[model samples]
Every structure is written in C-alpha cells, then in structure tokens.
Target: MSDVLVAVETVSRAKQLKAATGALHEALDARMMGADLFSSRDRYALFLAMQRRLHAGIAPLYGEPALAALVPDLPGRAKLVEIDRDFADIGATPPADEPVFVDPKDVPAALGWLYVAEGSSLGAAFLLKAAEALGLSVEHGARHLAAHPEGRGLHWRRFTQALDAVELTEAEEARAEAAAVVAFRRVSRIAEETLAGA
Candidate 1:
C-alpha cells in the first residue's frame, strides 16, 4: 500500500481514488511529450495513434456486467472510431502495431481503469483547443477530444458518483488503485513510443 493511499483512507472514495493515483498521473504527463506532440502534424498523428492504442486496450472492459451496469454510456464511449475519423481528416492511417493490452481481472480493477478513461474526457477540453490550433475540430477531426454530448462536467460527476457507490474491501480498493497506476504506465509507454515514431 502506498503512503498516499493510506493517508486518503478516511476520505470519500472519489477523493481517495484521485489521491492514490495522483503520482502516477503526474509521471505519465511528464513522459507524454506534449510540447513535441503539438509541434507538427506527424507528431500529432502519432499522439492519436497512441490514443488509439490505449483506448483499444481498455475497450473490452465496457462490456463487463459489473462495469456496464454502473456506466451505461460505456459502450458508446470507445474512442477508436473517432480516432479513425481524426486520422482520415488528417490524411493519416492508424499505426499497424497491436495495442498494449490492459486487462483487469475483476470488477474493482475494471473500475480503476474506467476511472482513468472517463476522467480523460474531462481533460480533453484543453486538448480539443490544442487540436483546433492544428486545424482539427469535432466535425472534421479531433472528435475523440470533443466535449461529451451530455457535457463533460455532468458526465464526470455521474461517473464518480457510480464509482463511489460501489462497495469494496480494502484489498479490492488497493487493487483498484494499483490498476489505475498500471493504466497510466501503459498509456505513458504508448505515448513515448508514439513520440519516438514521430
């Protein structure tokens, strides 16, 4: 158990979740090579390829009963199609390599993965603007970074509400936190690979 997790034990599950995953998030961001991504079209395409890989890795979890029951919108949230649209708009094809698989063996772990995915939509507001600066838009490209149809804030609140509503043993909670860190690391690696390829 991490000291951060231990310290957040008394907080709401959502807060605990955020606190536990904070370090992993920061580390992943540091490795994402954001400045380089926005510097060129090829770099931006590589970033989208990385997004495709990460989203594909977790796409299977949306169908799990435990996850689907809580997040009904899960099925529609797969970003691969939107990513493909963005690729077409940019005159690029998706990379041929297989995605890094991120399998969560149980419900709690799936929740952890979903937390990262759903939370990403909240951050996409900034990314969307950055994409626009590259001449991409929700209608033409960057659909994956577009604001949710239901609105970002409402969508995230619903997700966190369902997340907190789930009951878990301490062990399960730890597993969830661990899974979140794993998700971050996997995406970070993909980002690094994308930048290298760019």
Candidate 2:
C-alpha cells in the first residue's frame, strides 16, 4: 500500500515482497547486528529465544491447507524441533508462545507472514556460520540454522516458484506486502526486547 510497492503483476511475487519490505529488512538487520548476537553463548541464547518464538509462531503455516496447496513441500520445512534440540543441547529451558499469526483469517496476509518465515532460511547460512564461531554446530546448538537437506538454494527456489505462481488481486497484493512488514517488525521487536538483557 505504501509508495514502495510497485506493479505487482509485472514482477514475481517474491520480488514484490522484497521490494515492499526492503527498508524494514534493513532496519531489522541493523538492529540484530547491534545486538551482538553471537559474541558469546549468553548473547546467542537470546538469538535462539527469538528464533524459538518465530519458529513456533510459523510452524503451523507449513501445514495450513491453503498454504500447503501453494507450497507442497512446505510441511517438511519446519524447524521447531531443531530449535528445541538446540535449547536442550545448551541445557536451557525453552520459552513458549502461541503462533504469531494464529489461524489468520486473511490467507493472503498469512502468505505474507509465511514469506518472512521461509525467507529467513535464505539467510541462515550466514547465521549458521556465526553460530559455529560460538562452538555450535548443526548437530549441537545450530540445528535450526542448518541448510535444508535439499539445500538452501534449491529449497528457496521451490518456495519462490510456488509463491510467484500465485495470481492475486491488487488489494490482496497490498495486504501481503503489509503483512510482511508487520512480520519483520515483530521480529525486530522480539530481538530488541530479548537482546536488551543480553
């Protein structure tokens, strides 16, 4: 709905989403960077806390009938269990919360939030490397950040192909963009609150 949204029909839905949320993503990334997320285990725990919340929040999206119809392999991508293992590996009690988008009435908007969740995987390669610096590994405290067995590039390609194939109305497109901004802002808020203590 804002000036950043372009002709949605002219570009892939994935790009439309990226363009719509570019500013928000930059801000979120900057905020996370300043949080010193991997300087030590204590700080990294904060990162995992937020990751736990996020993964739990979006885990159901992978199974939602409408979304699954769009992304067939969606159900296999959940990482909540991996996050829990990371907590156990470090002997930390994992935090708990309901899904961020609880049975969202707006499927289009739900897709936007789901986009943020799946899109995070695309950046996990870097995050996983940072975790390794903290003496974490895929089998240890960084399982959630590990690339998909199919690999991040191929996995993301399958996801985007599914997303870009959708035909949505102008209003639906706007809603999707707005929902993505909201999702990113939520992550920023969660990170800020959690890292404040770290």
- C-alpha root-mean-square deviation, candidate 1: 5.5
Writing each residue's lDDT as its tens digit, candidate 1 over 1-198 gives 656544544577778878888987887766664446766777788888888887778778866666778777777767777888898999988877464355544888888888888888888887788778988889987889987778999988988888888889999999888887777778778777777645
When summed lDDT is taken over every stretch of 10 residues in candidate 2, the lowest stretch is 97-106
How many clashes in each candidate?
A: 0, 0
Residue-wise C-alpha lDDT for candidate 2, range 26-122, written one tens digit per residue: 9988888888889888888888999988878877777788888888887888888989999999888787774566465467887898789888899
TM-score of 2: 0.90
lDDT of each: 0.79, 0.85
Model 1 lowest lDDT segment of ten: 1-10
- Write down the TM-score for model 1: 0.87
* Count of clashing pairs, candidate 1: 0
After superposition, the stretches of candidate 2 with alpha carbons farther than 4 Å from their true spots are 1-9, 102-105
For model 2, which pairs clash?
none
Clashes of 2: 0
Model number with the top TM-score: 2
